[model samples]
Target: MPTEYHDLSNWDIGFAALLIIVNGVISVALKLGLEKKLIVASIRTITQLSLLGFILEWIFQQNNWFYLFLIILFMTLTAGYTSSKNATRFYSGMWINSIFAVMVSSWLVTSIALLTVIRPETWKENPAQFVIPLLGMILGNTLNGISLGINYLNESLINNRGRVEMLLTLGATRWEAARDSVQSAVKSGMIPILNTMSVVGLVSLPGMMTGQILAGVPPLSAVKYQIVIMFLIASGTALGTIIAVVLGYRKLFNSDHQFLYERIQKR
Candidate 1:
């Protein structure tokens, strides 16, 4: 933030575009069709982030608690929408469940970090700098993990409906019948975070702590902050993915244990 103001520095812009193309090229070279994903991703990202940039500028000016609440609400809403688009194999009109899961789970993690842990002395001082970004990170990760979890959850549930039916006939509750698949999906989603934690120090430092260190925050302080973020993400992902599947289970079947699959509007 050197008085020159570096919202999107030239270096960042160059690297971002370069990375996008390189990703696409590498994928196509390896027969992964990373090219198409990169192309579509570029347009979608540019349009969405442009709109968000304007909204955030205004949001920062209105830094009241309710405003913060509204901003989080908006993020939840958008993420829910896209996540649902990707989750059509499991449900329709599912933004509600995702919202519910993200609300309770991410907020619990974020609140513990901001209020109980960091205990920032004043909101106005760091609203844009720390809190918003951290909240965004938590919410974004929760959305991805939970949606990915439920996508696989639905597939497993449909495939193993016979097991579920058998369990139900044996008097298992609705929740119990689906517990195994739900647990499996949640575990799958959480493995990424667990794997990252296993190699955090030896393999690669995370951007949050690394950036902080580059900016001159003491190594110990940066490490502590990064640890808090990692823990919060792990906790948030676990809670979000679990709750999403629990709530999402309702969408997967009729009272007779039938599946409800649908298509999305194509984001």
Candidate 2:
């Protein structure tokens, strides 16, 4: 049998961190004034991932579906809250819409893929190990799309107010007046995923495939999993972006079909 992949020692890991020092150097030379932000980000990255490692280890040892579902709920809530930060303060309802959108898209796509394509028999045995990580992947991608869509939609409404108001004055329906902005917002959110799809293999190796290879999985097997995940991520992101943008734009108008500019949160 092939030997299992070796683990990294702390000393070896520290050597890998030299790149961060290089980043700090660049920041200083460029006068970017981002040393504090960089340091905080690096620290947060280590702390969060270290904690997640322990959490996943414990979850993997449990057979209780309730705990698994609770993790999913926490993930969905946190994703929604984080994404909502990108929205204008006026749109308090964005959190509800974002949560719903991310949950529906990510859960649907991730569950279907897990049950259908991946089909690890381990799921029926200890599902948390398989489901939680996969759900995280789906939610993470969907969160980005939702946040970007909300940000774009909010900005578009503000910047294109004149055009939208003129359309309404000319007897255009609310939907018609806002169709362009909604479409633009959705497109903005989907662009990153689209670009990744276009250049995935050519530009860079994706995280899952690279990590699996490092962990001693066969490259071809890792590639197949990566392909399936890319499909899930793309579909989930598109669905979430469309749903969030549609719901978000509605909140910008009232029952009279009049724009609610007053609802816009002041910067």
| Top model number, lDDT | 2
lDDT of 1 at 187: 89
* Residue 147 lDDT (model 1): 79
Residues forming the 10-long window of minimal summed lDDT in candidate 1: 258-267
| Model 1 lDDT per residue over 1-267, tens place | 223223557688778789888888889889986688789989898888888888777777766778777777777777766555576464565677877888888878887887778776855474655567788878877888887887778778767867887888887777788878888988887888888889998999999887777776778888998888889988998898888877777766558744443421223
The per-residue C-alpha lDDT of model 1 at residue 59 equals 73
The root-mean-square deviation over C-alpha atoms between each candidate and the true structure, in angstroms, is 5.0, 2.3
TM-score of 1: 0.75
lDDT by residue for model 2 (172-252), tens:
888888889899999999998999999998999999888988888888888998999899999999999999998887888
Instruction: For each candidate in the order shown, give its overall lDDT on alpha carbons.
Output: 0.76, 0.86
Point out where model 1 deviates above 4 Å.
Answer: 1-58, 120-128, 251-267
